[model samples]
Target chain A: MFFNLKDFIAEQSEGETDWEIDLSPLLALMVTLIPVLLLQTSFATLKMIETTLPVLSDAEQKPEEKKKDEIDFNLSLFANKKSELVMELVVDNKRLKSVTIKPDGEKFDFIKLQEELFAVKKKYPKENRLKLMPGDGVPYDIIVKLIDSSRVTPEKKPMRFVSSTGENLETTFLFPDVVFGNITN
Target chain B: MSIVHDIVKKAQKDSGFTLQLTAMVDMFTIMIVFLLKSYDTSTLEVKNVDGLVLPSSITAAAPEEAMLMLVSKKGVFLNDKRLASIVDNKIEAKSLAKEDEDFIEPLFKELNIEAEKIEAIAKRNSTVKFKGTIFMQADKGLDYSVLRKVMYTATMAGYGDLRLAALDGEK
Candidate 1:
């Protein structure tokens, strides 16, 4: 067989034209990014709650005569040091009852707090606003848990409410509107 | 006769080994899909700082782009810049009460600058509106007083809409 260098070069060039690009670098990049993205995936699940600072205004104060017939269902919760949770029910700017919840072992008794709040929810089905006034020393996690407890009834103990269609439905909406307030002792 | 038999046996053996990559490729494919699915691009970018573990919540709304303030046990930060140290879950009482008169000076200054910048941008661009919002990320262990001070400073700086950042609880 006669070896033709020109023809061999031409054939090699033609074969090169059909060659596939190496995707190994791209694959390596993807492999490297997967773990980084996985670590960052938690930020995607980040959530937020809209809160406003409690404003003090003279307009909020009204004469006692005007509010005689109006029943305010707003509940106030105070978490103090020594793991004590004080709950107060305010009706027409009057304190109805103040209940203090102590810790169960090493943790605050959230179940008891939920039960108390649930009772209030049952009494005032239309009232949804709650004021959580955490003491200066109370940790933020406890406040978040308190908010969680006040906002909804736990799944384990789902409350039953009659729907507009007259069908009884299990719901978790206890007090969705929460106003963060200063601890006024 | 023995040598000829050995040669025939050698000739009958398979030639080479082949590696199957189908299973590996499938694994990588699934991994890529899972990673992509878990990556959330809609939420605001948050970097984990030391001593700042976000509390978990069941809410699902994404945060808007706004001034970022981080309150941790170690210190208070505005957009990653340390403004003040937290002692006993409170910013230096002197600075808040007398020096700044119930306002965190550094945080207030930073937030005021940001609010003014946003206001300027809104003035030039008719479509842009200053929402006066701040995205606050505080450590789960921080006291409410610290959060209150930070939030109050932010509100005074004209960022009234406070969006508290938290981790999404497992549903």
Candidate 2:
């Protein structure tokens, strides 16, 4: 025979197993994919900032709630266009102490506000209602931060104090009951 | 010396060899799975709207599901519908249906229509009440003026619950 039988068989079998597949395309794909996937990954948690409670329907509202609106929750803060935070305390709907917190340059002093709030919480530990009157052109984040400062202590913990009834209470929030005074404005 | 020579000879033998892909394939599979699993897919698949950035909050409260409203620098969207255009961080005056600066007419009308739909459904279905809750997603840099307009219109349309969307951040 002109052709060698063993060599022919060896040549046919060699093509079957020892094949090294080109991995450059796969490598390219992986190189492109890893960064994309990593870029798309998010470590941050999406949260919701709870504003004032929803208005209940007339039929769903309690008599106390309806009358509660008429009752003065005398604690209020006004964020003027100059970004000054004016905290006002009213008793019997009469003008009481109006603490004006002016901003240093452009930034409102939230830390000072928090400290002031600590004092306010000490006096009216049971009062949780706060009327917020934010200015027209103020940034939304400032208002949110202001709410946070008003509701919690400077340490981000709940405000702690004793009640008006001489009961020892701790971890009570400052003023979570916030009413947007400028919502209609 | 013979063993060394044999090893050298084997190195010069057949160059063709199959890649051990099982280990690499396994690694890639694990990586892909991990990356895909890490993606956040909870609480109203709220996506990143262009020009809108959410501020981080110290509060750990989780987001709730409701009507989605997105306010970017470019425009104002309600449930993914563009209701008004914003110019210079404020909604365009032309977008206002009424002369009132606080009222965005298109937004009000759409919200009214949505309120009517919910109310109509509530009339027959006692279980489903119109809980006028709006899940607001506004840019951190946006002015309170613009947001107040939207809020005012929403309240007028009978949706009073305003939940501002924020990113859960470090304490």
lDDT of 2 by residue, B1-171 (tens): 344334434554655444455566567767877888766556564467888988777753788778888999899998789989998987988887666778889998888888889899999999988888888888889888888888888877778777888876563
DockQ of each: 0.27, 0.28
Off by over 4 Å in 2: A1-42, A53-71, A158-164, B1-39
lDDT of 1 by residue, A1-185 (tens): 89999988998888865444333444455667677888767534677878765433346676666455446566989888667899999876887879999988868898999889887776667678888888777888888888888887875367886654466656687787877766222
**Predicted structure 2: lDDT:** 0.76
Best by DockQ: 2
Kindly report which residue stretches of model 1 are placed more than 4 angstroms away from their true locations once superposed.
A1-40, A55-71, A161-170, A183-185, B1-18, B59-61, B97-101
The DockQ-derived docking category for candidate 2 is acceptable
lDDT per residue as tens, model 2, A66-136: 35424354888989668799998886688767899989788898888877777877766757888888888
Q: List the residue pairs that clash in candidate 1.
A: none
Clashing pairs in 2: none
